[model samples]
Target: MHRTASIGLAAACLAAAGVAQTASATAPETPATYLERIAAIDDAGPAIHAVVAIAPDPAGGAQGGAQGGAQGGGPLAGRAVLVKDNIETRDMPTTAGSLALKDNATGRDAPLVARLRAAGAVILGKTNLSEWANFRGDRSSSGWSAVGGQTRNPHALDRSPCGSSSGSGAAVAAGMAWAAIGTETDGSITCPASVAGVVGFKPTVGLVSRTYIVPISASQDTAGPMTTSVADAAMLLTAMAGTDPADPATAEAGRHAVDFAAALSGASLRGVRVGVLRGQAGTTPALTAVFDKALADMKAAGAEIVDVAFKPEARMGEAEYAVLLHEFRKGIDAYLAGLPGQPPARDLAGLIAFNKAHADAELRWYGQEIFEQALAATDEAVYRKARQDARRLAGTEGIDALLARHEVDVLVAPTTSPAWPIDPLLGDHFLDIGAGSLAAIAGYPHLTVPMGAAEGLPVGLSFIAGRWDDAKVLRVGAAYETVRSARLAPPSLRRWGE
Candidate 1:
């Protein structure tokens, strides 16, 4: 009865938002025009290098169908979406931003890609990402990749575009695509999206399928949307959410197919209690100032804010790393071994060897210590125990406890610190201030919307909710976004400090 009432109330809110769940038509632009615009920004102006490869139209031509097909096929019909390299597309190489799988053209789209196609979306192309999704080396940079080079921030050419979904976030921010698909293992999706001045959403773990995606932690990995607006993210997510027979994680996915964006309209924060997260922000004046303004806006919108203390398992990080190491080998090996075409390396050991052989290119900057550790791991008991312990800390003891104790529907925090300068020699020296781990390790849905900028770079405010409460979470964020619609365009990278 409680769940039913909540659903009904949410439906009423959506009807009041003005637009229907379906997207309205806009003046159609040529796919070529989009590509030209993207190339001008990414390849020519400041060399953003966001897009790794532009996929050919399914019709075997450069120009994709831009017209909304007869009857307006689907909400995303005729939309051009950029997918991260790690997510498979039948036509393009799924490199995961690595030199090893440069020829990994599987000719088999992942389940999510099929859903996008069924919804009439044009698969624009693959975007660059951190090599092996930033799990290869401890010293590796966020946007640096041997396959597609470095992806520079659109806000500042020298700024870091946080990864491993670096190119997905950067490309969407630069108008390369209407939206993009990005997979997250921990902070991969939200971090890049927040720092890039875009909207990023990580759905509940089982809300989407993970088949054919390059994996890090099976316990945490899920692909979500990176877009300029919460509406766009919601639309993309709606198309991508469904159950996959191949992935057991999504057995309950169909039960979560609510219209995420509809709840965004006329949404109010009034009478809603939000727990202010306790971690990694409020230390720096710039970040704190921006966050304080966001809080003020929420309060002005009538939200009751309360401070809460959350002590995540002291050893959660250690356990998460251990689980990932063991699971990466299990997951990556299965994915590689099953590919139709022969990839450069079929296993972790071979991939490591290929890196050594191509040292001038792949290994020029950093060693694959993480890969080595994963390859050497043999303790199944340790992996299972770590997964259990981390899930408990991140779930029941972390996000759940806070909400229950504080009596808040959602939690808020500074998504991350402002973008840091991109340093090639030392790699990413980030502020490590995001509250992503709580939702990430818990397999809960997390949303990051633009808060404001700090030092010419953007920061975001995050909304964290209980598992499978994605619609409510989106509504909460939409309510905040209603008051603070600060989603801005990307920066002209050539002129940074002038």
Candidate 2:
């Protein structure tokens, strides 16, 4: 079938299956113009706090204005994007959703930000995130932060938006921005995107530069795109990727970077081998039903699917947690030291003290058990061993071994279960899910595409590809997205105070 026909056929199937489509009537405009629209929407009454700050220049009036007329003809000339607060932009402050660094602004843009600006994408603003990317406390709510407050899910006002990259996901879903940049150390991007009903791509470590992003762990830290469509994610990623002299890890990215949007042909998934990770199943019956339907769609699209069962050792999660705690302290210290102007928290010790001093504001709901644990573990030797073991087991023995044995291009699983009930008093009811650990431990690329709705909430099907295979992952995701046709329209209450 022709590519366009395939999309039409897929759309028809989805509509028949009860997926309603809402047409957006707005015509294409420059990125600068888009920002102006955002300001008009957000600044009015019932304003949602999705955006932390807007850039000084509104679209259309500025030199590199939002309409893509910037620098003559840049790749993302007319695209407007919201960047998560954790990713530093010289145009905005890098608060990381915390009051500790409320005034902190890096003098220069992050490498990824520089790439976006070079491609002519306008920085609409910074989106709210879980304070310190949700690494601060064991009982922290996914989307709540001391600085930005709670970001409501666009799908349901009463529901949670999920963590770390919550505002980025919500903004994209609500059409506040065409796309947004989100940083993930583990489940941050996937969880938020899954709950908000958007597409999120967590590229392999080093696939995108992490030079100015707030750190949890250098090994697992990476920035990715959260967009309404898989194709949009690919377009945003193509502009954000490439080697960065500021981050040594990006040296490995090399030619792994490619025009991901160009790889979104209809037949991209044809003859591709996909392995279903059976070990991660049995969360919710609704999710399973969606998964089955998705599998059927892929089969109709001429892709091979195999059910593979290879659960990792139980100790892997514990070991991974240990590594993150140790690395968070060290990585955060390094990041703080390099910040321009006065440092907010000079080291982990100072950060701990700052949190304690501002407990009423920062620790209103959750206690800093995770931070305390990191503070308690001062043994370097034990930390090094745990970190090494986690990487070896998760990367070499876990994900890599299973993919090689199955000979699959990607491993598929539920990005997350359904959106749990949002309870500020009790925090997130995430339970024990199979996300974060695999990708976080293995340090591989993981992408989440909207699969279907479960009880009026969104669910995402995950794609875990091998290290540095970002382009291939994007291609496969875009192809499946075309077949699934599952992107959702924002709820009626998307505008703040609605």
Q: Pick the candidate with the highest lDDT.
A: 1
User: How far does residue 200 in candidate 2 sit from its true spot (Å)?
Assistant: 0.2
Write down the lDDT of every candidate, Cα atoms only: 0.80, 0.76
Off by over 4 Å in 1: 1-29, 58-68, 485-490
Highest TM-score scorer: 1
- Per-model TM values vs. the true structure: 0.92, 0.89
Model 1 TM: 0.92
The sequence of per-residue lDDT tens digits that candidate 2 reaches over residues 262-376 is 7765536789999898668656787788888888878788889998887677788788888888888888888888788886588878888899999899888988888878877
